[model samples]
Target: MDEHKSLADNMDEFRKLIQDLKSMSITMVDEDQAVILLNSLPKSYANFIDTLKYSRQTLKLEEIKSAINAKNIENKASGKSDADGLMVRGRSDKRQWKRNGNGLGLRTRD
Candidate 1:
């Protein structure tokens, strides 16, 4: 094949293949189901998806799941939160953290 196809073109071809699969008697697809599936991904899974896409490395579903799970555990252990920057706890009245690494504002719970 002399013609080179871009990532977007290959993705379109893949989409067409999936759509064609929907026409088969045994296969079906629902946009609502797809949206729900995508929305249900954990933060780490979403991160993993981006990493996988960018790295262009082939990996199994199990491998991706394990990686995401490990990352989630690590984040939980570090007192870091899935929330946006500057995680605030029940005490907003508490003084702001210092720039120094003393307490580090890293308040992980056992």
Candidate 2:
């Protein structure tokens, strides 16, 4: 898995790899597939992987895939994914009300 690529891209690659293996008559258990996917994640996903890996319940490939997809959505929404070129953060501060040429205070609030 490439850390430089987005989670979606990595997941796609993983799916392709699994497809190729299936074509070659390679078979793996669900647990093994989940483990492989978790292991293939980037270092940024270490915490997520550990959380899933150490869970008490048996691992399911579909669940792992769902979690990855959810995480990808979250990262993209927060501008934290590798695929995002820019990150926007909200800032809140107080500033003195200044009058402009129009004789009105130039202040905007949310």
Candidate 3:
């Protein structure tokens, strides 16, 4: 799944599928599973996916799953957690403002 360059959580799902497959005689069709795996990929892979799709490449599930896991691990090691990362989005924390005796503007705690 990772070698297919899928996401970590998505790869986990594939791992689960393989485990579950051992118990059941019936299994999901490889191509459908491949597409499902592809759908789990991030937008950065859009062109790659389109190329693969147009080129009619048959994706190997196990390899893709492995690749995804490795990439996710690499990302985890290199990146910061959401809370620790830069806050470039959404509403910021509210700040309390107060007026001072001098008639000039001032910021104060609530």
lDDT by residue (20-91, candidate 1, tens digit) is 767785463343323333334444346655765456444444454455457656767997444325446695
Q: Least accurate stretch of 10 residues (summed lDDT) in model 1?
A: 1-10
TM-score of the candidate numbered 1? 0.34
lDDT values for all models: 0.47, 0.84, 0.60
The numbered model that scores best in TM-score is 2
Where model 3 places Cα greater than 4 Å from the true spot, the runs are: 1-10, 17-25, 41-56, 80-86, 89-110
Instruction: For residues 28-98, write the lDDT of model 3, one tens digit per residue.
Output: 77776777776756665565556655666677666555555565566569783212333578646666667
Determine which window of 10 residues in candidate 2 has minimal summed lDDT.
82-91
Candidate 1 deviant stretches above 4 angstroms: 1-48, 84-110
Q: What's the CA error at residue 28 for candidate 1, in Å?
A: 10
- What TM-score against the true fold does each predicted structure earn? 0.34, 0.70, 0.43
RMSD after CA superposition, every candidate: 15.8, 9.6, 7.5
